[model samples]
Target: MTVNDVKMILDACILCGEQYIGKEVHTACGADMMSDVLAFVKDQSVLLTGLCNPQVIRTAEMMDIVCIVFVRGKKPDEAMVALAEESGIVLLSTDHRMFTACGMLYEKGLHGGASD
Candidate 1:
């Protein structure tokens, strides 16, 4: 699904990189802790997180995640938004909690990361 589709599905507000709404993403993983994300995530295109810090963007960059969805309506601060924009990552904020947000994407065919 495209980032636009994700935003629509999650009813998210774009916090940055609006130009990248058409970006394609097939896999997603949700985690508020960056440590779990770094340790377990792989080949993932999107991150659904409640973490609202610069580290989230850094982790996305390290793992090549193209989009970040902030769950439970959490919005990152301005510096965090700047970091994401500079790194070419699209940021989205949604009111859905972690589990429900992740499930919504899964139900729409966006799945977990590939084990490869």
Candidate 2:
């Protein structure tokens, strides 16, 4: 799905990287644990998380994630947004909780990436 598609599905507001809305993202992963995200996610371009920290952006950078959805109406602070903007990772916020957000995306055909 495209970033715009995900936004529509999640009713998310774009916080940064608006220009990347047309980008295609085949897989998604929803997790608040940065360690699980790092260990389990591979080629998952979209990250849905409730964690609103600079570490989330850093993890996205390390995992080459293209977009992040801060679920349950969570918003990152200025530094985190700046980091995501600098990393060219799109940031979106939604009212949906992590489970609902992930379920919505999954129902819309976005699946998790392969795990080793």
Candidate 3:
């Protein structure tokens, strides 16, 4: 599905890189810990996290993630938004908790892209 579809599914607000909302995302990984994301996340995925920081942007850059959805109403700072914008990574924020957001996406056919 596309990032715009994800935004509608989760009722998320675009915080940055709105131009990239049309980008397609076939996978999703929700984690508060960047370590798990770094270890297992695949490329062209959407990252759903409660942690709002610059490191999240850096991690997305390294992993080639297409979008980030900040859960539980958490919003990143100006610098983080700028970083995400610069990297062409779409940022979205939703009031839903991490689990619900991930579940909603999963129900819409977004997987973690993880292997056994």
Local distance difference test scores for all models: 0.91, 0.91, 0.93
TM-score ranking, best first: 3, 2, 1
Runs of candidate 1 exceeding 4 Å displacement: none
Candidate 2 wrongly placed segments (more than 4 Å): none
- Where is model 3 more than 4 Å wrong at Cα? 114-116
Using TM-score as the measure, name the better of candidate 1 and candidate 2: 2
Residue 50 lDDT (model 2): 93
Q: What is the lDDT of residue 114 in candidate 2?
A: 59
Q: Roughly what TM-score does model 2 have, to 2 decimal places?
A: 0.95
Backbone clash count, each prediction separately: 0, 0, 0
Give the 10-residue window scoring lowest on summed lDDT in candidate 1.
Answer: 36-45
lDDT of 1: 0.91
Q: How many backbone clashes are present in model 3?
A: 0
> How high a TM-score does candidate 1 get?
0.94
Expressed as tens digits, the lDDT of each residue in 1-116 for candidate 3 is 99999999999999988888899897899998999999988989999999988989999999999999999999999999999989999999999999999999888888887562
Q: Every model's Cα RMSD, please?
A: 1.6, 1.5, 1.0
Best candidate according to lDDT: 3
lDDT of 1 by residue, 1-116 (tens): 99999999999999999999999997898998899888877663889998887889999999989899999999999999999889999999999999999999999999886562
